[model samples]
Target: MQFTSTPRGARLARRLVSHRLDEWGHPYDSAPNETLTLIAAELAANAIRHGHVCGRDFHVRLIECTSKATTVLRIEVADTRTERFPSLETPTPPTVDDESGRGLFLVSQLADRWCVAPRVGAPGKSVWAELELNHG
Candidate 1:
């Protein structure tokens, strides 16, 4: 899904992702739906806030890759900023009475696996996260 690269775009991304999850049989309040929605909102907001390059907008793609034994939902957010990739191995932010800097930690808890990669065949970066579906 394409977004406007503004605050409204970030909001729309969250809502669109929720709607898509619902369409995929995960209702808005379900565990997976809620987790994806929260991750989408935070990542999209970060893309807009930290990766915006003037009029260039960000894009979000949700994909499900499955085999006989497992299914994974991949959440990818791409932005136009080539140098704004996140460093996951960086040290954690200090916790001395802070009101900010906790998004990635939350993501680490929700996502089974997540990483940032330079966009292949493009000039931007993509932050991708995966959640494993409950197969039981």
Candidate 2:
């Protein structure tokens, strides 16, 4: 799904993810759905705040894997700014006490694995993450 690089876009991404998760059998109140929504919101917000390129929008995709003892949920967010890849540690938010610079930290806490790669056939990068779903 493509989303404009704006706060509205970020909200939309989170909401749509909730919808998709519900369709995938994880209702909005379930752990899986709630987790995915948080991941979507953070990734989408970063895509808008850091990866935005004027009129270009970002794309999100969800891939499910159930073969493992725990299910694997993959979230991919692609944007048009390849140079502004997310940093796992270094966040220069211009100030020490600022409320920013903790997005990836939260992502790390939630996602089992997360990384950024060049967007296939595009001039940007795709920030991808995987969440381990609880089978019980």
Candidate 3:
């Protein structure tokens, strides 16, 4: 899904993710569902805040995969600004009074694994995170 690089768009992306998770058999109140939605919101918000360009939009993709041993939920958010590369190697902790620098911190804490990479054949990058699920 693609959305305008605006706050409203970011909010919509978050809501849609919750709905999609419910449709995929994870209820809205479930841990995986709630955590993934928060992650998606943060990613989308970052794309808008740091990568938005005039007349350009952001993109989001969600996928659920089940292999022989595990099920995983993958979330990806892409933006058109290629110069601003995000690093997941060392996320800084936000100050107690800081209201804004905590998105990636939350993602780092909530997601099992996450990274930012250049988008293929595109003028931008994608931030992706994956959450592992136990089927038992």
RMSD of each: 1.6, 2.5, 0.9
Off by over 4 Å in 3: none
Question: What lDDT is reached at residue 82 by model 1?
Answer: 92
Query: For model 3, how does the per-residue alpha-carbon lDDT over 22-112 read when each residue is reduced to its tens digit?
Result: 9999999999999999999999999999989899999999999998888999999999998998885768999999978898989999999
Query: If the candidates were sorted by their TM-score against the true structure, best first, what order would they fall in?
Result: 3, 1, 2
**Can you give the TM-score per candidate against the true fold?**
0.91, 0.89, 0.96
Q: Write down the lDDT that model 2 would get.
A: 0.86
- Among all windows of 10 consecutive residues in model 1, the one with the lowest summed lDDT is 85-94
* TM-score between model 1 and native: 0.91
Tens-digit per-residue lDDT, 41-105, candidate 2: 99998899899999899999988889747889889999999788776553343456767877777
lDDT of 1: 0.86
Give the runs in model 2 whose Cα sits over 4 Å from its true position. 88-96, 134-136
**Candidate 1: residue pairs that collide:** none
User: What are the Cα lDDT values of the candidates?
Assistant: 0.86, 0.86, 0.94
